[model samples]
Target: MSTRRFFAVALVVSLLVAGVASYYASSHPDGLEYVAEQTGFIDSAEDSATADSPLADYQTSGVDDARISGGLAGVIGVVVMLVLSTGLFWLVRRRGTDDVDSDDARPEHARQSEA
Candidate 1:
């Protein structure tokens, strides 16, 4: 498939998974939190540095409705991830192009001398 089509599908899937499926997820702790509780150290865990952020606990703060808050948080998270990944990929692509251009600009003798 074309890159644009692939990315479009990926974005849609990501949004659906995060915004819709996330609402059905179990509220009970599953991984590390569960382990900590079972081991009797759950209380010792420190709050995340971002604990006070509006979207801290998988839900938007002060949103009133639980479903809406969680869904909005999920959508916002997906958008932020997409933007960051796109920027990182763009930078890497540009860096690769620069490397190729610089290599091409060097004379054959200069290229050989660097080896």
Candidate 2:
């Protein structure tokens, strides 16, 4: 398959996995919350004052469908991380190689002195 088709299939597969994860996520407090509750600090957990944030509780602020909300957030997080990692790698990879000519390879000490 073409690169585009491969990416599309990968995305669909990732979303499906995330959807399943959302379906199976625990209703009880997670590790942090459980610790807090057991330690008698659960009351300290205040509502995020940023009520306007789109993702407050790993759920879209106003979304009512639990599965859809979590799945969407998971997908969004994955896509954002993929884009950021790709950009970082591209930047690092583009720093040298075919673009830099052999003639520009001045001695390291000389190059450092110029700066």
Candidate 1, pairs of clashing residues = none
Error of 1 at 43 (Å): 3.0
TM-score of 2: 0.65
* TM-score winner: 1
Tens-place lDDT per residue, model 1, 39-97, is: 99999989999999999999999999999899999999999988999899999999999
lDDT by residue (tens digit), candidate 2, 17-103: 765576687788889998998999898787768756786666765668887788777777777777998899898777755456553
TM-score of each: 0.85, 0.65
Highest-lDDT candidate: 1
| Model 2 lDDT at residue 104 | 61
Query: Model-by-model lDDT, in order?
Result: 0.95, 0.77
